[model samples]
Target chain A: MRRLPVYLVLDVSGSMQGEPIEAVRQGVQLLISTLRKDPYALETAALSVILFDAKARQAVPLTELMAFQAPKIEAGSTTSLGAALELTKTCIEREVQKTTADAKGDWKPLVFIMTDGHPTDDWRRGLDVFRQAKTGLVIACGAGPDADTTVLKTITEAVVSLDTADSSTIGAFFKWVSASISTSSKKVDLTKADSSEINELPPPPPQINLVT
Target chain B: MTDQDSAQNALPRPVERAWTQLLEALRQAGVPSAEEGAYGFGGLPPEVRRVLTFIDRRWPGAYAASDSATKIEETDMPPAPADPPIVATEQPAVDAAEVTPDAAEGMSMAVSKQTILLKNARIDQPYQETIALEGVDELELIDDADTGLALDPEQDAAILKGLPRHSGDFLLRLRGWRADRPCEISAHLAVIPDPKSLWVSKESDREDPFWKPDAVFQRVEGELLCIGASKRGRAHAKDGLFRDDHVGVSVDAASGWHIAAVADGAGSARFSRRGSQIAVDSVIEHLPARLQTHVSPHLDALVAAYLSQAPDAEARLKGQLYRALAAAAFDAAKAIEAEAAAHDQTAAAFSTTLVVGVARKLEDGWFFAAFSVGDGGAAVFDLDAESLTTLSLPDSGEFAGQTRFLHKSEFVDYEAVAKRIFFAVRPSFTAMILMTDGITDAKFPTETLFAQHAQWFAFWRDDLAQAVEFSRANADLQAQLLAWLDFWSPGNHDDRTLAVLVP
Candidate 1:
């Protein structure tokens, strides 16, 4: 089956400690549970979780949606968005199969990076690598007022700003993500035209707006 | 009825006349036919039209046709390179390309004007052949049906195109003319089977349910006792999927040949579970006959030379055995490929790793040969020595969790494959165990663990031996082995397969 690999890069730093972290955790769980109900996502969506703080680690490797479990969110010292970006690239290279001349590989990955704070490390290098990726649709979300929308824009054209990191807003963002994933996963077909690229995502809720 | 008769017969009552008048009014209002104007873009408001136009321009396939058309023009119109005209061959056209000196050198075959003959060419490695064509213009290399490339005349002899990876009849049809007579020649090419290409998922119009039985076990008794079981991993079980590993055992009492095979289907491959099943079943079906025909004649001398430690004798024996085993593996790969083709799918959709072992009972001991294509563990537990000897070691790639699969197209190097074939003539070995990476990753994570953990094999030998002795039938023993295979570690979960042989 053609798989739509989805990676979630989340900021689990000191700033996102109590409520924000809890919201992220709950939101991710909700996203996974909702995706499980979608037959399309269950068959075609492979999910991975990357957590960035002082360092980045693949908390969950790319796994089919049926087998995927949301990783526990732990707040670390500082946001290492650069490390997270690098790790995501590595994960894509290793896990996602790129189309070749002889055989078709996996579909282009769908990546969502949610951050509530600016990177403490040099993130430009990671951004450059990500930009050079042959196949992926990256969406960066700035969670709350403290997030640097300017930096998020540099990372991806599809940037959204969440007004608050409250549970309701975070939950809405996740619900939108689940819906977008379900749409993309259902659209993918090996025999038809390429449906890997997401053209129109589900509109964000009132608390979330395009960071134009 | 004709249109005029139907129209004349429809003389309207008052309601019918009103309906006809309404239909005429709607037609006069410029209602477009569904086929001609389904979207009714003209009827949309100006603002909506402008927004739609903008969005349509950004749509994925909007520019695909134009872009591809331009690409086709560029590729198809390249000027033919200048080259001297070839002299026509009047000698009643030789049936096939003449074998060049390259054929004697190695796996290379050079053919001119005639069909290219490829015999036992390695499937795991890429092969290139020199085709000597005379008086041909505009040679087109057609790969399958959809893709074709024009060959450069100036560099005709030096051209090296990669051969097809799967085993089947491939055609290289030369459509250019010879002596301006419109002569066409087709080369019937054959690729020796390798493991099926890795399986990738395809979208279906209907829902394709992905589920299979979790585990399977089989036992066959003859000169040697063979017990094997394959179990689904915890991760797969949680996902409601079957085990991607399969095992098969075949024993020929008359020939004293005990054959056992195990295959691990690639987890990422969509239909690898089927691939693994096909591979194991094929090997068990084919290996015994292959050994008797190819290796039996030289077995006695080879074993005698091996026992005496004769120079080159062991190497010779190993080579012969390797070729036989490789041929068997290729047959298994071909079977899987054929199955995929029958299902209108590519061979890669059934990619798997294969390991097969053949052992013959001797007067005092057993003579065994084992071959493997990917990462798995095989060992002999010597009862007399109380030591475990590693046979076929796990071959890993550059990174962790990376290993070559039998289905990889680049796996055609038989010499490399030969090196991995393990052969031994031991006086007394209590048991032989072959396992997939699922068990090895948890129990023997590294080469060191494989060496240090003699107890692991000992546990299996003792438990299995007792089970075999106590159990009334093979089913009971199979159940015991299946339960034992469920041993789990904290994080490592993968499909497990184990085949054990006792003499």
Candidate 2:
């Protein structure tokens, strides 16, 4: 039950057009591919992908890693994370139901949110839902030049800002994520473990890094 | 902190002053803001009045909880996640005018005394569905257009009037079992001779994770049965050893004429996880009544019968749903095991053990049949026995020690599946348990785990009878059973699995 499922909320707005979008796509691909190869990950994990710009869409439902497929990122006009947030809550609500109370109800579920700009749609309710869930963990990442770090901070306890919004930094974050997942997957009940591994994760903007 | 003072002082502000106030209020309440000019809250009780006042100031003319807007200086409104204070001029918050229970009120509705009742039973959704009374006003079935998963409509977007901070997702209360559990049917169980692979996968390997069972399966709710797997593993992963074995309930939901099949991976097969996954998924997806009627109750014939279907189902799965998008999620999982082998990774993620249960609801009663391969065994509690007993089927060799793999193409025949199967004789008053080897070692010392849980649950149903409670009891059995592999099992460890069938 310690096997946690992750939800990735990615912003595919027009501002992330050329390389930014490509890096994101590559970043996701790298993370999943890395997870698939991990021993603990193969045994204790699953993934769900949600993409949004003007509207929100589910590229993949909650599924064990073997069945997960990285979706192609298509940049569009608006950045509507509100829809993505709403949908993410719904997805977790339903996915978690699939698990019984006796098992890993304590299994840690972490949400990795990556965005470039502020929500184009009303996102107030989405934040409320985030606060209400309290069941899972949320990590927000602000990318490129336009990302509003302030907005990202509002939604999560852990926030990260990236420079250039390129693959190197994105890939670095993913490698760290892969490590975290591998660590998290080792136990069905993650009680006491090394916090340094988790804390060492990419810090929020201004303090973000490109090297290991 | 006084509402009157905050409002009077708040009076001297720019036209967009309310926005700053909203953010300030949120921050004061430990609510972070998205922007500096974002909304803030002044001095309001965590109640509805304060939130309504804030909404009025932002939209000025839009949002209305009762009928229209009012500028009251009372701080009694609770905070909520709803439409942005500003109306959706160019950007609206999720279908804005949708009349969301004002932020301050929605939470209260989620947990209010207003009970949600599942309406009358129908064929498609025979199970009674929950209907929220005054608490929830509307429901939306937002299905992810992709994946084909139908989202629950009852909880989607609701409006609650006076929400309390204690509120969260609406507390769902299921009604009595209106219709029969989905895919109600009978099937004959076909467990190949053991002493072969299941009970003794270690004879095959010592360090591999695939050689042992890590999960258990149960049909707790809806048409889709549930599966939970775990192992204690390395010292660092000791917590992994704590699996939730509901003390054996999947084996107890038996009656006359119905068959429930559960399987565990050998932990040795690179694709054992898939083995168990495909075994369970295939049985649920395939295993028609006709097939159930074909297998004989006797274990030896069942093994012969189970073996014949192995190759066919595996090959067929590749072209059919069991392999493609519909590929049994478990089967796909098994493939990952194979991939691990190809790479010679330390995970040792290959072979898996298996256990299966087949149950049917008949005119007489619920009939159940089961099969256990690898290290695990099967048990049943007959009212006549007074306690749970092993349904000792045909084991090819010693029950005292580990064994070898029997069927050559087991992947195909897992679901009692074969062009030709021998139907089993119906048993009366039965409780059965099918499990992996780790269970036999130190976990299920009582050995009578099947009867123990059956009796305990029977006491529960006869005593404090709550269906959900009963379900939890069963899930716990699975968790505990799987945990044994993670903890007590020696060596690097192996897979552990157990399935219970009751009649």
Candidate 3:
């Protein structure tokens, strides 16, 4: 009767405007559709998305995937993966620390960050703060030709390089992502128990991107 | 086991009463979990489960990476940051003439029916794929057999990793053999070899490393077993008989767990033989102590710890080892990274693959966890997956048998991407089998060999006379799984090893 939590720390920086951000939106919906089909993921996984530009915006909070609604994709000025990073750090720290929440804190939640450009803010500082709280998996994906993605790679040890922003891959990549999640969830259940004694939470989602 | 089930149903009354009293007490003290079913049952059983979940929920940064085999429990993590070089690689233009609907549409269609055994896509089509979940949330989906991370054609080392989809080899589609059956299976699979030229030692007329019929596998009772089968493959004069490569472990009957591990050093690297010895010695030497030091003492954790830290998780694995090994494998990986550096060589300098296993015999039934890494593969015959098939762990999307980032590095950041992935794999399961790449390619889909319970039960109680006799007599089966370095592995004289343990 426990649930799995998933958060999206999306990069809505300046460079994501043209086709990149739109592809991300479509992918998000595809992810939801994929989860709805899996008996395990639907019952266990929850979704939340935060969009960051010069500042961070919460597209959605920690809502069940079944009840999730697609938020509007709004592009803004400057690439601030650092600010988005910091916002993500706070939101997750709060969610994990929330004692009043219904479900007992589940697996350290999975956080996926997608970005086109690099960080316009001081990345080192944000990274220092983020690394200190080791309760989650933070995977960053860099997209497009102009995005300065160098700084985002420093967030988590796992950084997936997405080659093109081609709208076609957006759906395929998400489907692949969903398939992997289903497989891991199945492996997790088979490997451990549902009683919560093993604490061997299934691995968080992988970071992926669209090649432009 | 049935009593345990009954115990699960009999909610704790006394503890529930105590919880009510405590909640009342906390009313004055300002605490919670006050009433309702939350307090409906509170006893050692429920409390134990509650405590475990609570600790995981409350502890920030306690969970380790999926790749690691341990948890980070209530420890102070040093301030470490990740910095993967974020240089932008120019996106190549898509060629319109070469467009295929599946490729352009991005939906992944099943290609190889041999998911049961190792198979490849078109040799010329660039067997690379990247697909996202159509609708899903968990991020664990990208590790599938088809997701290729390094499939670029121009890279130099990429070519060296292994042979590209062989032109003449038949392609097999991956099939799910255990959908409705038991989680365990016994299967027969062909051990594949690397098609590269360098996999073998040359000139003098001995067994060629690629073609050397070295690797082997078997099934006993309901259990799957692999051993140091091909001593003839290690016939080279340069390195002595690969006793380290020939290492093996066996599990006994008990609820407790057992483990075994073996590893091989890349022949091209200097001191690689020493590295191989160090890897094996580390597993044999440190396993007992690590088993005892770890709170639960799982068969899998012991092997994982030993493989990460040799002789000592304390003295040797200071930096890279810490990153490779979890800090909470009862001991921090950072504590021994220094020793790793001293013995370390570049990717080209020294490289070795690990073979490990974790096992347990529980009262409810029996449990075994085994896995392979790089090459040497481990087979698990469980009745769970299907009564008949033995499941082979799929390759980690290898270009061939070759892998990435095992090379020497200047920096030893505990959070390095390479270290986080190859090392520091969070302990997710209680039992496991780990092995070098050499053994994995040696297996072909052979479920018929291990699926019959009646046959397996006899094999379990049967003596070695029957078991060894069958294996030695089956020359056709044996040749199908020889070490590829002899037959074709990138080239042999490649070190091969395996370990199995049950507790």
Quantify all predictions' global Cα lDDT against the true fold: 0.67, 0.45, 0.41
- Per model, kept true contacts as a fraction are 0.00, 0.00, 0.00
Every prediction: chain A TM-score = 0.94, 0.85, 0.80
Name the candidate, 2 or 3, with the larger lDDT value: 2
Which structure is stronger by TM-score: 2 or 3?
Answer: 2
lDDT of 2 at B284: 50
- RMSD per model, one decimal: 29.5, 24.0, 31.1
Candidate 1, residues B1-503: lDDT per residue as tens digits? 46634433342232223223433443555654223434354553333233223222223233233333211122222232221111111110110112233322221112235444322233445665565666554444533321122344457453535544454434555544343233345654544333122122222222334345677778888877888888876556554566788999989776778888888887767788889888888888878887887788788888888889899988888888876787788888788889889888888888788888888866667788888877777877776676666778567765434566666353478667677778878888777888888876655645666775465555555554554542335556766777777663433457789888886
Q: Which runs in model 2 stand beyond 4 Å of their true positions? A: A1-3, A98-106, A189-212, B1-452, B455-503
* Candidate with best TM-score: 1
List, residue by residue over B22-83, the lDDT tens digit for candidate 3.
33443454433323222222222222223323223233223222212223233322111121
Instruction: List where candidate 3 sits over 4 angstroms from the true fold.
Output: A97-104, A193-212, B1-503
Q: How good is model 3 by TM-score?
A: 0.30
Q: Lowest summed-lDDT stretch of 10 residues in model 2 chain B? A: B181-190
What TM-score does candidate 2 get on C-alpha atoms? 0.34
Per-candidate TM-scores read 0.50, 0.34, 0.30
- lDDT, candidate 1, A79-146, per-residue tens: 89988998898889899976543334677889999999999998998887766565467888899989
